[model samples]
Target: MSKKIETDNTCNTSRRNLMKGTGLAVAAMSMIPAATATQAFAQTSEWDKVFPKSDKVDHQKVPFNNRYGITLIADLYLPKNRSGQPLAALAVGGPFGAVKEQSSGLYAQTMAERGFAALAFDPSFTGESGGKPRNVASPDINTEDFSAAVDYLGLQPYIDRQRIGVIGICGWGGMALNAVAVDKRVKAVVATTMYDMTRVMSKGYNDSVTPEQRGEALEQLSHQRWADAEKNMPAYQPPYNELKGGEPQFLVDYHDYYMTPRGYHPRAVNSGNAWTQTTPLSFMNMPILTYIAEISPRPLLLIHGENAHSRYFSETAFAAAAEPKELMIIPNASHTDLYDRMDKIPFDRIADFFGQHLA
Candidate 1:
């Protein structure tokens, strides 16, 4: 376990303390009404991913239902030439606001090259998925999206359901940990470039926000509900994911990946539209990492770039998690660098971790 949550050797005591919660936020979802419930979604026929399709893997767009019944669309990746036997499988998704086409798809495609059945899917209300009122996030349902992927993989004749693993990039990394805490079937989990969206939303960066400030923000979220009611389920503008010009380097990194050609996809929430304004309402009270320690004895790998702005997310999570867990730091890589930088992403190491653990 890491002694401190830091970036560039700077640490914060408040953030570390906040991360060690009593794991009570697991059942806190009845607070918010699930606005965007399950709905019929159209699956596209064209290859709409930002990354090019790989020749070494067989890729397909598929849909599966989460426990919440939300329909999610995912790009399925598998080894092109298999020996007609059950193989270890992996479900990949994340970076919070990002679609599967950008980072998760790349991870899935790469892992498929290393001989695993990988599925990269869009969370509900984003990409080719189904949810009403456009873009939104849910602590409970989003976590279920991972298990739903596992459910789909387990049904496949080529997949070994018992030997299943999962990989989550950026914000989904935190959700991956949350999923493993509840879903014991996930034998191995590798959360790379993690971000606890709830932590960042409720506590600000490094837990800098005061209790008073949190109260004030909640007041605003309270008002937004009235605004949402007034709109009658109309498209609500997102509070985040817009570049207003000349921002910080990390935002620039995200802009480069999401707003530009490198990882731009029309359906991605981060690429153009903003996430819904009420996103913070559920995340503020719910701590996603509370049950992280329970994902023990199962091989857990938390990877992050040494210089990533969000490095502390993985650090704090690693500290809370129990045995058979390892944290791997990618030297000189930033948060978005792991998104699509094949050179920085250790596909070989990730393959080794999943291969050995799932074996």
Candidate 2:
């Protein structure tokens, strides 16, 4: 068994301690109202991804139910001329508010071309997926979303369930780690340009949010629930990825990918819409990577841009996870650069990692 790291280098919050009560959070997550499995979703056949459609892979829209019974919509990608034998599969998601049509889809398609069955799904409540009071985010449900994807992939006749792996990009990277830690069926896992959404929400960027600030934020969220009760609706934030003059470079980079044509898709929450006002509440209390060390014995690979503002999230998580773990820092890449910049995204290295482990 992999023992939890006693200390974290980037932040003082001990995940070892936080994991003590994770069972309660998991139990609470199981209680979040589930929807019917037969829920119908409308999808257009037109090619609408931010990235160009790849001809080397066979792509199709698929829907699968999570344990919460939310129907997640995904695009499945398989190699065009692969053998009849069952092949290794992967479940890909993330960057949080963004949908599968953005970075995750691109990753899935590229990996499919490299001879893996890849499913890129929009996490529950986002994109074409089925969840009420839409655009809500959850540390637990989102983590479960990845495992749900694994379930779907494993059921397919063409997939070798024992050779399954996961690839989480940006914020989904954290979700991927959390899911793999619990879902041992996964043989290997990789996170690229990762962000720990819970860490960022709870502690703020770089753990800069003081304890008083955290308390104040939680208090505001608690009170906001009453207003939501009165309105019978959850309020949403203002349109995300909007840049006023003089924003930070990383924000500008995000705007470039999400708001601009470079990576925008109409259905993506981060593109032009907003998340529920209280979306941060669940994440603030639940540290998703609390049991990251438990993923050991399953190879874990974390990729991050050397200059990304969120690099510390990966570094912190890397410190917490046990061996057979590796942290790969890409030279001269920014956070968003890995989103769609094929030249900057290390697909070959990722393929090699999965190939070796899933073999």
Candidate 3:
């Protein structure tokens, strides 16, 4: 059976930072319920401190269908008081295990304030989206999520169908690149703090998992599936960052955001629940970017923090892609910095990239 997780009332600071440049506050002022500003401020302290409020965009809830018939939820952001013609549209999603309400929504809303139509959507089986056996992932279905967003945007009256772009953050960054590889409708693509999910699941980070280790993982997953069938309950694993003493910096950074009020969203799997215990099997067997070179002619922007533990994923992907591609490294920033740190993320550069290509 399918179920939708109810969103928590906690106001995320990371989300607020992503919306700072958008004039959503002023436009939605009257629409906002009688919640006290003090309450809002207190609940949003971590996020607000990092990202000041923006009062230049309009935000609204939007629901659309994917090819699988799952009802995906998104927060649509549109620039306020724009001039001439309708502009290009952008569809953003990512960090895998996370909902649109977190970093992806922030990215969409921020870009919208920069004068593009942006929609950040929750992938199937997660967040407010409708799906059965929650927290499962598939390479094909996930890639289709991007295409479905494109389909929805193309039908919008205020959008230029021919000029559509996409931004994928973290794990979704890899998925977005995979989408652009085959979908010609994507005119430009930006992958921020990217992770190649296939590589990590198959070989483990930094190729720490040897062929024998990989085989053991496969055997474990296969047996876990049989156990799941017998028990009739989806196995759940806790977030990797919930480590104790002597954890790695990458895990520590993840904890600071996903596990705390600063970035937590109730619907985020990474913030709480683990995905299906058997998800590794598919991710291991599927290499998402085997045809990455085909994405040429359309521009690709790959951004990563120089110190990010996952920087190699973007470097390798950039090398795999053909011309009309660029790789930008943010000095001294970590993986999560690109998730919501506006000062660290090159928004102006991203805006310019999309504008040039989508034009």
Candidate 4:
């Protein structure tokens, strides 16, 4: 168990400061009936998800915009055997560069089967979402993306707005916490196989990058901006998830999921495409977990594999957070296993957490 910290007023003040530039305006507050929402967004009827469609949940494509007006495309999952009551709902996203078609969709569908409405969405500038200069990433905008999903879910007729929660996987887990810290509308949150993207980007893996190394990396990125300005377009790195040889075990794990038949999708960045050369510029200085303790009153569940390379992220996050938090570690499991492994994912415990909190 990670030691719980006492709430600090300074943390709350810092959280308020961070929220200044990341504010969101809910586009509409009126109820959005399913039929009208479906008509508003052009949805593909065909099942294109990497995970097989579940018979227990109704699935559909929907769109909603963030404060930046970047429209996000998402998959909505609802229980087939609904009792005609307003149901608790969850907004889901990430593993970061992966899309709604991969692990997020699987989590959403499985949660829907357990009796909550769930939405799995692509962050701005990725997958089928609407963002220009495709394949870019932003900590502020990406964290705002979750709140946007919450706004969309709260507008649905069948969803109980007060009972809404969030689930973030991989890198988005950090974003989820950042979002919830400010957007108090989310009643609970669960982050699995979490990665603090900003931390990794700024400090490098395991905080191994020296201060000199960090300065050099920033210098390179700054210069790349000049090249991008000259070309009138950001240059992309080579195709992602390619195994050249002698890669780290974690990279191998990522390749196995994104490059093989197991989790491959044409639209996923991790599957094949690449992010812009300057994508790290925004995340480098923007620490997303600076105010993690502010989510104290709202319960948080952090789930990680015992052997996951990213486990330290969740442990550290857990220690930083205030009370009403729990860190669950699945024995002998790797980070990617929680992405899709039903046995290791601990869906039952997740449902129990939301069930207790959202009720």
Candidate 5:
């Protein structure tokens, strides 16, 4: 691992420092919700997505600027046969380290088939989107990514503008609600198989980590940051091996999904490398969705697989969210099952919820 980190110094330099402009500034700069900084993305015209192209929807690769001034790339899907009379539009993203070519694209394409304009976007630093320090995750910048999608949707001539909605899968589900709390432009929201990335990072799974443990974790990250400053590169942790033996069931599920043809994409972190080790530094202090109650009056729908280990994320988020919210659990779906299992995703329910609320 140390050998790889030493050898891959060029890309490793991007693991965290590229996003913040300077190594000394990452901790503070990343915490700011909006950035004045600009970045160039490596845009692609090739059809290299993980999922097969849909004949039912017309697709295009488009780019939009986020509140943070980072350019995010997205796949826009429109029903091939459009009525063209100001249709409702939706934006989709997440499962944490995933790019848009996996579950998010599937959801957007499915929604487009049901007569809504849909966009599945790569968040700030991941995928083909802009932002350097190749893998950095921020609770604040990520939440802003959703609102920027809303802003883009609102400006389209064929869209209703006022009928914008968002779906966040996995960690982004929690981010979707955070976007709604601040941007009332979003009339409805849906979060599927969600995880509050911050919650899990700070408190450990099931809120089992003690404050002392959290402090120790923070101290460890601090040392990592010092290492980052010393090496002039971010700390690195290799992703779990896709074909390794004797891993836990959930990790096996992840391996089957992201590392194989079932859902593999060249740009996904989970499909190859993991996030920058120091990326957790921001999540340690920034509690996202603290104002989830503010999302009330706006409709929210939470979906999770009944057997998913992360089901508690949706449960707690649903509990904290105000009126006009609904939670649905799929009988036997696991966390990774919802990433690509169309038959198990309950697209019908998603369509209905967005249809009614987005109307």
Candidate 6:
């Protein structure tokens, strides 16, 4: 287990400026009525757009419902010059709390540019998706979110149902693997900066949390459920850790992206309220990758940054899986670097992997 390192001077300066700025104030002031917060978060200004509209692909807003009846919203991207032929389809989601407007959409647009039809979706209960008591998480529901994406992609007119694939970023990487393990319809899978949410919830980073600590966490969540039911208020926790002076570079990198103008989205749970207090309980026991080995024969590509603190999750998953699995580590990159840093993220390798597997 890697010990939490102190934040450097540069990180401290950035964090301090960020907190003192209007961003923090806006986020804090949003804690009023839940309905108002939801509305405010849903508003996306032109300046907040992450990906420029692609002229090479046709884009449309599509909706589909999961078994949970949560209406999952997705932006479908299709190549304009498909020549009326069905192309391989890629479904993407993640970085956990992020909406499709961020990394996922970028990936979808790029993949479409590379001749694949793609759909980037907001997981159930987040972004444009419909679910009550906003900003919630569920292991089963989140896992199902990927399958719902696959379902939507498989039925698309420009997509070859048999050549469907998935790309999961950050925490969604775990969900993608879990989805492929069960769906069998996903011909290939790519997990970037993957995180096993179950492992993190149960053991903390690098398994620092002891067994007793895990039990205590579960206990607290159980009690919080009762409190939430009684109060009729949404159970929320603060962000994982505040950016303070002398924190680790990885922590600072996360803060720079998720907590700042670089990646902040009003609908993002991590950007605003913490996830549901009870969310960790589901993650604690629901090991999403236990069946990862079963995904073999179907290719799995695990990409991680060499310097990413959470790289071990992908390493461990790669070791657990069977043949036809490849692990690529990008040099000098940290966990969040792969999120949106196009130059650092090995898009060529990703394109080759999908092209080969989906062929």
Candidate 3 lDDT tens digits, 17-106: 332333211111112222111100011112222234457887777889999898887777888976758779999999888877788878
Off by over 4 Å in 5: 1-41, 241-243
Q: All candidates: CA RMSD in angstroms?
A: 5.7, 7.4, 13.0, 10.6, 11.3, 7.2
Of candidates 5 and 4, the better by TM-score? 4
Q: Name the TM-score of candidate 4.
A: 0.88
Clashing pairs in 6: 6-246, 6-247, 7-246, 7-247
lDDT of 3 at 352: 94
Those runs of model 6 whose alpha carbons end farther than 4 Å from true positions after fitting are 1-48, 239-242
- Summarize candidate 4's per-residue lDDT along 1-359 as a digit string, tens digits: 23332222222223112212211101010011111100012346689888889899998899899999998999999999999999999999998889899999999999999999999998988888988687778999999999999999999889999999999999999999999999999999999999998887876666655677677777877877787799787777556778879756677888999999899987787886777767788888899999999997999999988767777798899989988899887776778999998888999999999999999
Ranking by TM-score: 2, 4, 1, 5, 6, 3
Clashes of 4: 0
Q: Per-residue alpha-carbon lDDT of model 6 for 286-359, expressed as tens digits?
A: 78889999997898888887667778788899888888888887776778989888898888878898998889
- Candidate lDDT scores, in order, read 0.79, 0.82, 0.76, 0.82, 0.78, 0.76
| Regions of model 1 farther than 4 Å from truth | 1-42, 238-241
Residue-level lDDT of model 2, residues 242-270, one tens digit each, is 78786557778888899888988878777
> What TM-score, computed on C-alpha atoms, does each candidate reach?
0.88, 0.89, 0.85, 0.88, 0.87, 0.86
Task: Judging by lDDT, tell me the better candidate of 3 and 4.
Answer: 4
Residue pairs with clashing backbones, model 3? 13-47, 20-54, 22-56, 23-55, 23-56, 23-57
Per-residue lDDT of model 5, residues 13-113, tens digit only: 22122112222212222222322222223678877777888899999999999987899999999999897699899999998878888889989998999
User: Scored by Cα lDDT, where does model 1 land?
Assistant: 0.79
